[model samples]
Target chain A: MGLPPKRGDLILYSVLAVIFLASCAASGLLLFTARGGSDLVLEAVLDGKVVESVDMKSLKDESTIEIRAGGGINVLAAGPGGVKMISADCRGGDCLRMPAIDSNGDVIVCLPHRLIVRVRSRGPAKASPIDSMTY
Target chain B: MNEESSRGTMIRGPRKIGMIAVLSIVGVIGIFLIDTMDGARTVTRDGVAMNTVVSVTLVSAKPKPQLNAILDEIFALIGELDKKFSMWNEDSPLSEINRNAGISPSAADGDLYSVLETARRVAMLTDGAYDPTIGSVTRIWRDGTGEGRLPSSEDIASALPLVGCEGLKLTSGGEAYLERRGANIDLGGIAKGYALWSIRRLLREKGVGSALVNMGGDILAVGDGDGDRPWRIGIQSPSKDRGTPLCAVRAANTSIVTAGVYERRWEMEGREWTHIYDPSTGFPIEGDLLSATVISADPAEGDALSTAFMVIGPARSLDLLRILPGVDAIFVLDSDERGMEVLATPGVRDSLEMFDDEYRLTFVDVY
Candidate 1:
């Protein structure tokens, strides 16, 4: 039979086993608790006013909505999976380049046009509070 | 050989137990750290009040029901404040004082009395540039704007005599009276700021560590933002084309109040008329400045100062801001040569971040 494991070897193995299990548990919690539901609504606000809200859950087909305000226009697309700004007249193009928002509280802001597109829960899904509002 | 084996076995048993205990402690610590780093929670509620959209954001780990209850109380408090301060409310305390103008001193509530006192002091400091006794002029302008017309000069002149704050008398026992007939008081300029202070006080009393209150455009930050970051506030551009921010400021436990010509304006007969009026002339103040933002430890002061600065114009307002302690201001002006110019006090300059290249930033010396 092979030589018995030494004290140093046992200690190293025990520490490694603890770390592995801890990491696994952390990842599990993140995966299960952090994922948001698919039912989401997107609110388009212009000049601190809500102009329109499109429900992603109710949409059966992909469509685009154009908002014209303050001498600028922004086009937003809402699909079954998510919503995104497809086009805008502003110079920065930051809103257009923003990634698709699938979860609640994700915001796409066009500073030049003063337009904000934010995703929210459709039903009574738990709302995560924001720390502060800049406007 | 047997003795050696027994000694090794004894060492192994205790060592294994010690190892398990250490591992359990590590696991517990790791879990806590993960939860703390990733589980920071925030809740936001939005509603309409004071003829504007008000949003309250709170950072808490409390249950949803508890958080909802706190927000409900806040909203209800705002409603009550509206009833007390609104000039539109015929039964409001302010209306009662207005109706009893030049007749008798109306017994005011404790809060209303304090707010009026503060307004009187600010009006004196600004030399009537931020008078609360301009209710008659404001009423005419409101009606004119609603009808897409400008108030006639004769009407404005008639209202001017009653626009001075000196005509309003306040007693030591919370009694208020207007010394002149037709003189009225409108708290539109200062009421929002007072409401913000009230909200902050309520949140503090309720053990809320972090909160942001935004009533219309007036903002009050009570504590640190998420992850200890300062709250970032975007200053709206005065240009009508909207989307681009003129600048931004980071605030913590302070109030920011902005008075912009764009907030309330109407176009009639090829001219633009804003709602802000000069207490002296009883007409909208004419200036190149597009907006004035005031930052102060006191929200009420910030609110009143913003209107005062807007009325005082850029040069005189900058002078007044220098002498005022614990207050800062930013002025966005329409320059004839340059496209636009941003003049700010030292404190305001430090926190202001200008995003556009076309706009020039100038720092004014307080001393």
Candidate 2:
């Protein structure tokens, strides 16, 4: 038979158990709350068709993709951290003006070429409840 | 101490450990539940249609496969609509109608005929402010201004005569004809709204209680945003950056469409020219009003009125809104003294949440 634990021992074990449980809860929360950039998937669509879907985490080096559609050329650069339209022959060059998108739900559109590049997260992140914007 | 008491203390220590273990398990489960509370109930898909961005948001409890099928159907419908309405597409029904101008009547699809009929009605309602036959002039502006060259007076004069609704004739037998050789019909003003109107019916039929379909900037919101509250929509600011909204309105089961000169405007020779043209003048509209947003049950009406309001200016648009039932408008105008001013119809005035002091807001009385 083992010796009966002293009251001080019981108190120490109780405190340690509480601490362990609290840490477990906190770690679980952090696991869910932290947004992993690796989960981002970039989808490039041309003329209503999804032509390219690349996982950002899979690309170890920066690469450029040239998309020719609607008699226009749009150059897209995708790397580990983000994706952006580096250049486009489409009128107004609006796609070129758009900033690099790293976060989920970010979109870059070139209207003339009918090209849309957007980021989708394969995580538990919630989409905005606001329905739409009218401009 | 008694042996039994000593044994009880040892057992109590184990019990404490067991309770902690149980709590740790429960805590992990609770955290997981928090993470997946919504469980991806919202599905959003975006594509390109009608030469603009088309996005759909659906909220439902259905399994993901069913939801994905619903999204596929929606995009397919948009693609069909684009083929029927896009004038830029040389093979589109609208282009077919333009091709047969002064030559022969071209057969229009049933949907095309109905939309053209609606276009005629809107043109009459707005006193020719929303004429569909202004396509000739708009085409010239589209090509000329795109190259940073404004259309000459001679080009405007030639197209001006083609800008009347009388030139467009839609027969009950599903044939449409233009009276003049150069006359054209452009659905750019209302096609997106019509698309939204159809999408609304389709969503309702699919049992989607909450959805939002945005074709470019024309928005149709149904039910709640996320199955609980009205969908909050932002009205794009004319003077500020593109994503920055002047104000927001809570909408449910309604359509909000905005047309702005700032979207496709260019500065040349120290003058600014926009895409929205005045039917009578055959030139880009010049007025204090920079953008107009219309809210109504019918997306088509909202879409057409947003353009007509820009052509007629703020005062006349306010008068028209006072008489039009179930229709409200928000007009953004340039004020030399106030910088930017906003005039909103009474129906939407109470629902607006202003974002900044950059613009002065006034609620125009419908009475």
Off by over 4 Å in 2: A1-43, A47-73, A76-84, A99-104, A119-129, B1-40, B143-148
Model 2 RMSD, rounded to 1 decimal: 7.9
lDDT of 2 by residue, B222-306 (tens): 8856655678898887766555678899898899999898886667989777888889899878867878999999998889889
Interface RMSD of 1: 8.4
Tens digit of lDDT per residue, candidate 1, span B257-306? 99988765656889878878888888887878889988898898889889
Q: What is the lDDT of residue B297 in candidate 1?
A: 89
lDDT of model number 1: 0.78
* TM-score, predicted candidate 1 vs. hidden true structure: 0.73
Instruction: Rate residue B27 of model 2 by lDDT.
Output: 70
lDDT of 1 at B358: 68
Q: What ranges in model 1 sit over 4 Å off?
A: A1-40, A43-135, B1-40, B240-243
Q: Give fnat of each prediction, in order.
A: 0.10, 0.63
